[model samples]
Target: MTQPWKPDRGIRHAVIALGTCGVALVAAGAVLDSLWLLGLGTWCLIIAIGMELIYRP
Candidate 1:
């Protein structure tokens, strides 16, 4: 049987890093009561999702 297709290693690593940073930003935003940080983090998470959709199908 053929192996299933997979994303490139760099893409996988970048996605993971983006997710980690997104969570960290959210946490920092809460701690500092900063709406700007919260919004930025939210956008980061959304971009990660978009990338997955574009690349995984």
Candidate 2:
């Protein structure tokens, strides 16, 4: 018999937190016109999306 998939809540929460931080950073970067912050935020967002997809339940 095959078992159903289960998500790791801790990882999920961390991913969410990362995504939120990425968004906040992106917004802050835009407001402050900071290229480095914007690049970092974009990188974080990409990693968050990759993690969510790879670790899906």
Q: Report the C-alpha lDDT of model 2 over 1-57, residue by residue, as the tens digit.
A: 854754577679879988998999999999999999999899889989988898874
| Candidate 1 lDDT over residue span 1-57, tens digit each | 855765466677777888888999999999999999999888888877777777765
List TM-scores for all candidates, in order. Answer: 0.79, 0.82
What's model 1's lDDT at 3?
Answer: 50
Best lDDT goes to which candidate? 2
> What's model 2's TM-score?
0.82
- Residue 8 of candidate 1: its Cα lDDT? 67
What are the runs in model 2 whose C-alpha is more than 4 Å off? 1-7
What lDDT score goes with residue 52 in model 1? 73
Q: List the residue pairs that clash in candidate 1.
A: none
lDDT of each: 0.83, 0.88
